[model samples]
Target: MTNHWAHPTAIIDEGASIGEGTKVWHFSHISPKTIIGEQCSLGQNVYVASNVTIGNSVKIQNNVSVYEGVILEDFVFCGPSMVFTNVRTPRSAFPRNTSEDYRPTVVKRGASIGANATVVCGVTIGEWAFVAAGAVVNRDVPAYSLVAGVPAKGMGWVCECGSTLTFRDQKSVCHDCDREYERNQDIVRKTKDV
Candidate 1:
């Protein structure tokens, strides 16, 4: 028997791979060939389409739909009612139903998408990046960046522990987690205390 837990109302189709300790709550549907990693939580009304890949410890809140061509790495957080689009331009008359027509979206490890955010396809959300609520992400987000507003503009940098970083001469030390960070132009990276 699988070690995962799915509520009675949840539909886990055949060929879906759910890792140990994964919990799928009410009204959730996991399509065939989808792979979800260990300790993940899929909240109510979550719909994960076929062939989607979600990594360990991912938390997908209620009303979220993860379509095909979406890859969520470990520690990713998808807040309530967040949207993910696979097709760039959708026309009902001419359907782009095939996987080749879909654009792939990769959410890197530790990235957090806030509530009601919409992530457009083909963009890479960098590791430890944070997308604020209701933001529409259309472009690639740099690592450790905090992006907000429509179309998602980079507002500041954040530590791995999710605290906002204040740089002094391009260098910052997190007060919450005591981590060090350095900013070089548009890119930010964790640095060693030396």
Candidate 2:
């Protein structure tokens, strides 16, 4: 038997793969073909669809539905009621033939998606990117970027420590952690410590 712990009300299919130390709370549904890594937490009413892949130490908050064709890497945080859509143009009359018809959405390592945010399909959220609450992300987000507002334009940079960055002459120093970053146009990457 798997070492993962789930509440009695949770429905975990026999074909699902849950790693050791993972905790799935009440009313969650883990579908077949899904693989969740170690130390992950699925809060109440969460739904992980078939074939979804989640890496280690991920935190999915309450009422979130992780649809098919989505991959979440290690250290990712998905906030409450966040939305993920697989189809770009979903029509009720013309149903999708299979899960392969769905577009892939990837949230990279150390990324955090805030509550009620919407991640559109086929978009790659770079490592350490932060999506603010209620934002609508329709495009790719760069690493160490902080995006907010409608359509989720890159507002500024964010440190790996999860603090907002202030740049001077395309060079930013994270006051909270003293990590340095170089910004070229819209792309930001950690360079060193200040």
After superposition, which runs of candidate 1 have C-alpha atoms over 4 Å from their true positions? none
- Top-lDDT structure, candidate number: 1
Question: Candidate 1, 26: how far from true, in Å?
Answer: 0.2
Q: List the residue pairs that clash in candidate 1.
A: none
Give the deviation of candidate 2 from the true structure as CA RMSD.
1.2
Candidate 2 lDDT by residue in tens digits, 1-194: 77999999999998999999999999999999999999999999999999899999999999999999999999999999999999999999999858879999999999999999999999999999999999999999999889998999988889988999999999988888899999899888889955
lDDT against the true structure, per candidate, is 0.97, 0.95
The alpha-carbon lDDT assigned to residue 54 of candidate 1 equals: 99
RMSD of each: 1.3, 1.2
